[model samples]
Target chain A: MTVTDEYLSNNADYAAEFSGPLPLPPSRNVAVLACMDARLDVYRILGLKDGEAHVIRNAGGVVTDDEIRSLAISQRLLGTKEIILIHHTDCGMLTFSDDDFKRGIQDEIGIKPTWSAEAFPDLEEDVRQSLRRIENNPFVTKTESLRGFVFDVATGKLNEVTAS
Target chain B: MTVTDEYLSNNADYAAEFSGPLPLPPSRNVAVLACMDARLDVYRILGLKDGEAHVIRNAGGVVTDDEIRSLAISQRLLGTKEIILIHHTDCGMLTFSDDDFKRGIQDEIGIKPTWSAEAFPDLEEDVRQSLRRIENNPFVTKTESLRGFVFDVATGKLNEVTAS
Candidate 1:
């Protein structure tokens, strides 16, 4: 069976015990932007219950225009005031440079992507960079508490990254 | 304490019972793109263990350049082959139009966002839209299986959206 089918079978069990149809807005008034790393389970790490917070994730958890779009929607329409950004140790984003990645794709496909691959060499600096992007953005104005962290994959611990 | 502080406290407990770092690549070879809805816990819904599948999310669970970037990275760098797209019931994206959301932001701040708010009128159609976007994208070329679904909030079941 395809892995999707295997997960579909798992869903039958999830549905049997499911109690949902919660309110549309996030109960915790928070939104989390995190990396799409397989190891970082944002819900359990933050002790978040279902319907508590909006969880937005991507490759590096970097703040691109789309992330700004998601954050704006979270804060303005949904009443989410707090924003949390999570980048992890040993991230794929840190493993390669943007130019090299795009060049590799170009060599294969004969066309380069116009968008930034958003690879970073440093973790904490990138976390701070994400924090600053939100801080300076015009659309995401409803944030009351904004912070960033680096999640250690080995210990499953979140270490706060302060803006330098 | 702020909610962030409360979550930080929870992190301590998570770390207490934490395990060592798993491999960087997803074990399941799958990547799921879902909504940043408060209710849908993508990991539990899909029965994904930590280090199994990469989960990428955003406001509407829609595909954009950022998602293409993430999926490309997932397929090329991390070796994920299957792509699953999920949009849930009672989505906020269904509540408004792109024009109205942008107009409200424009009225509040003199500068309107240049990005699309990505509001949609229908759920299943949008799911298909996301699927088609992935199919059409040039960067994300490593897919072996691609499917889209709408997750029912009340029943906690995922009903597949077949191409029409």
Candidate 2:
């Protein structure tokens, strides 16, 4: 997998941006909602252009209320016409509960996780729930095509989830 | 600075999930919406717990259409009550425009950084823009006290942005 020269520190270097541009994405504009797990190389996996897609990542990528609202605006206000929800295998989010994270905060840092009640019991369930949740979400435009997939971090493959 | 036993890996043994009890956050429940920068070990720097706060990360950490919608719901529905917007001293978001990232996608795995946006052009303006973006966000419940801070990733010190 080709890594962008820009890492966390040098990402801001406009000069180092992708010099070899590819044909714009399928939609030309897309919105990606995925997990924050460092393992997932969103740009590389999606073959996306930097400015082409607005990437939104959080734990689990469960398509919560916030995600739905974002999807709604993405198609309505932003140029995006497609929604790609990526939930991958072996995500840190799937490993713990809110309490586990909270204790990490209390015992360690004085601060707390900003939002809570965000707990995903299983990985496959997260994918199933996210699909069902986004498909029915009113925030997303009814006509807008909402699709999801489970990414295999090991295989670097993307497969459509027909049921979830 | 103690790191969790959890290893950030692709083959991360998530097998324990079913057999293991869910991890819980500490007594303090705080959530953070920060940029996804490895340099910023927010939990470690802040001494946070894994589950204590709901950490939501994204590109630019810009609270646009979906972010606002999510923020509103996050406050109204989710257990979180506090929100922290942490912008680092040297950020890549300012250095590269949407075009820069879009173009750089094929060659890289992630959008890394090199030069600080500090001298590129609009330094404080970028930070101010981010601060105002979050402050003016309609989704973040005004009922919930919102705070913004710019942390010097180098020094590990924080300074609250009161202007916006």
TM-score of 1: 0.99
Restricting to chain A, the TM-score for each candidate equals 0.99, 0.73
Model 1 steric clash pairs: none
Predicted candidate 1 versus true structure: per-residue lDDT over B37-109, tens digit per residue: 9999998998999999999999999999999999999999999999999999999999988898889899998
| Tens digits of per-residue lDDT for model 1, A5-107 | 9999999999999997899999999999999999989999999999999999999999999999999999889999999999999999999999999999999
lDDT of each structure? 0.95, 0.50
The C-alpha RMSD in Å for every predicted model, in order, reads 0.6, 13.7
DockQ of all predictions against the true structure, Cα-based? 0.90, 0.06
A126 in model 1: Cα distance from truth in Å? 0.2
Looking at model 1, residue A61 earns an lDDT score of 97
Chain B structural similarity (TM-score) per candidate: 0.99, 0.64
